[model samples]
Target: MATEERNHVSNGEGDREEQEDEKMEQFFALLRSFREARDKRKHELRLRDHEEDINKKMKKSKASKLGNDERSSWVPRFEWEDFTSEFEFPRPLVVFPTPYNKKEDQKNQEDDDGLDLNLTLSSASL
Candidate 1:
């Protein structure tokens, strides 16, 4: 009877140990899930912050490029000058050369006309 009691006690202890081990495993699984969730939340927050920072930088860059303020606006210089009657006109920038030989050009025109007349007469005779 004593031996049976010892065996029963050892079996109970074994069962308790198994229950404790199962509980520890469940706790560790919950801890791992919580850690994963925390890491995911942190990553999402970081992405949101990075996106917001990029949007801010883009807005600033676009504002600078477009010159949204009056101080950054460009103004062209357009001053009117009053000219007096005594103001002399400037000389022409480009000068063309006169004909060098007008007689030679006239002789060439006469020779072309003679050639045309001869062609016409030869074609009529043919």
Candidate 2:
């Protein structure tokens, strides 16, 4: 009877050891899965950050290019003359926005023609 009891005790200990080993394996598997998920999320965030930075740089680069183009498209020039030999109540000298732009010159030409007709009619009446 004593020997049988010892055998049963040894078998129970072996079963406990196997249960502990299975528990440890399950814990390790769960930890590994968590680590993989964390790594994947970190990688995705990094990619998103890189993409956002690239987009921002592209926008700034394009905006700067557009600004440069617009600035180069037109440059203004001004002329000044001393106020001498002037006898008109309203100034008769015409001022233009810029002499280098032909489109503006044509637009102003129509206005000037109409204004000249009105001025001639007015001065003739006076």
Candidate 3:
């Protein structure tokens, strides 16, 4: 009887170990699958972003080319020598007379040399 009991216990332990092995394998497979799905999603997002950037750049380049063509036609050519030959610039007319301050002139002349005024008259008839 004891021998049969011992055999039964060993069989149960073996069955438990097999079940644990299957659980561990299932856990590892789920982890690998989740990581793969996350990486694929990130890759898809990056590709879409790059595609959008390329489209924006293409649009800007096309607009710049069209603008350049339109701007070149509107530019005016300047011939300065032809205008100067036909039109003569006259001198501007003087509106106000040049300011003449007698006080400042006298002050400048007094600073030049010795100049004295003699204003004395003899008392003839009072």
Q: Which ten residues in a row have the lowest lDDT in candidate 3?
A: 117-126
Q: Candidate 3 on 3-117: residue-level lDDT in tens?
A: 9999999999999999999999999999999999999999999999999999999998998987776665665778888678765459776689768899987996876466536
Q: What's the true lDDT of residue 102 in model 3?
A: 100
RMSD for each model, in Å, please?
14.6, 17.9, 16.7
In angstroms, how far off is 43's CA in candidate 1? 0.6
Model 1 Cα lDDT, one tens digit per residue, 1-32: 99999999999999999999999999999999
lDDT of each: 0.84, 0.84, 0.85
* Candidate 1 deviation (Cα RMSD): 14.6
For model 2 the TM-score comes to 0.51
Which residue ranges in model 3 land beyond 4 Å of their true spot?
A: 69-126
Name the lDDT of candidate 1: 0.84
Clashing residue pairs in candidate 1 (N, C-alpha, C atoms within 3 angstroms): none
Per-residue lDDT over 82-123 for candidate 2, one digit per residue giving the tens place of the 0 to 100 score: 345555667567777654888888988975666453435564
- Residue 114 in model 1: lDDT: 55
- Of the pair 2 and 3, which is ahead by TM-score? 2
TM-score of 1: 0.52
